[model samples]
Target: MTALVIIPTYDEAANLAWIVERVLAAQPQLHVLVADDGSPDGTGAIADALAAADDRVHVLHRVSKQGLGSAYRAGFAWGLERGYDTLLEMDADGSHRPEDLAQILAASATGADLVLGSRWVPGGGVVNWPWHRRLISRGGTLYARLLLGLDVKDATGGFRAFRRETLERLPLDQVASQGYCFQIDMTRRVAAAGMDVVEVPITFVERERGESKMSGAIVREALWRVTVWGAARLVPRRLRKGPRPEPESLASRPGA
Candidate 1:
């Protein structure tokens, strides 16, 4: 199977190279796509350098710091057009371990349409996260699960794999949420499509370098979007309207 792991970056120069190298070392079938937003930190240049040295490494340079969802969407489009059968999402901050990638991919290979690396599962946990952060994550996930009737544990988790066919079946153009909500949105989409999703336990380690992209705005956005979606879900399908098309100006585009 040809797998492409998409690592989204913004001002992550400190952690990018190390994470990319680890991911590449994990499996020979895996290739790296560094989707870098125009990080003034010169992360794009670093990605260019890595791509120059290794054929397995590729780069997608965005013009500005678009959110996490935009980066992944762009990466997915690029990988799909290149005929990659398997696409994966990972973080450049090292929170998502490369060592666990094999098990996730193996799960996907076993007829699962999507594989989620979950910290709330039986064998999964987080290292170095303080109580409040953990509470926020757990609470947010629980809220989403209760409201959305989601069965999975880590709907907000970012480490995951997708079959190209599964992605092709989903309405990718409708996804506009970013950060944690982006993960939740995809989970909802996959569940709605009756796709087989497997959650593998994975230990999430807090980033050792660089500032986290997490912000009050991101958390607020997740809460607001989930509430709106959940409310919409309560309406009967016959009564509910199809999603409104977002303006083209809001769409994300990569840099030349």
Candidate 2:
């Protein structure tokens, strides 16, 4: 099946080259689209250089850092237009392993609409995180699952694969959350759509370079947004379609 990996970046120059090389090596057939939010540190230029070196690598340059949701939305639109059968969202900071892409693709081929790289599962774990950071992540996922009535163990995970049909069906424009909540909200919507979603255990390694973009403000935004989404769902039929388009044919392109 054709696959396209969408990686969003702000100022990830330090890790971009290695991440891109590893992903390409892992699945030579997989095409990559880098959505860079005009980084002052030259991330966009770096991505362009990579794209120039490899035909399978593509780059989308945004004017500024408009948040992760917007970047992914743009990338998804680009991939959809090209007729990619499967779309993968991953961090450019190297937290997600390139080796796991094959597993996610395999899961999608097995009838799963969405496959998440889960860290809370039995075979998954976090590396290089402080105790407090671990607590925050665990607590956040647990709270989100309970409040949103989701069965997913890692709703906040950024690493995920989606079938082309699933992305097309999801209402991408309606996605409101920005950071981590955006991930949770999308996963919950997928489950609500009666699509099969699965979690594949993955090792989430902390970024070794580049400054973390996470902050109190981003976390607060997630909390607020998730609360609103959860509350709105209480009305049952009030939920609108997600920000993604309906499933489209994958025959238009060779890779996702």
Model 1 RMSD vs true structure: 10.4
> How much does candidate 2 score in TM-score?
0.90
> What tens digits encode model 2's per-residue C-alpha lDDT throughout 180-219?
8788878988999999989999999999999988889878
Query: What is the lDDT, from 0 to 100, of the residue 211 in candidate 2?
Result: 94
User: How high is the CA lDDT of each candidate model?
Assistant: 0.93, 0.89
Predicted candidate 1 versus true structure: per-residue lDDT over 176-253, tens digit per residue: 999989999999999989988899999999999999888999999999999988988887785687777876663464
Give candidate 2's error at residue 63 in angstroms. Answer: 0.6
The regions of model 1 sitting more than 4 angstroms off are 237-256
Query: Lowest-lDDT window of 10 residues in candidate 1?
Result: 247-256
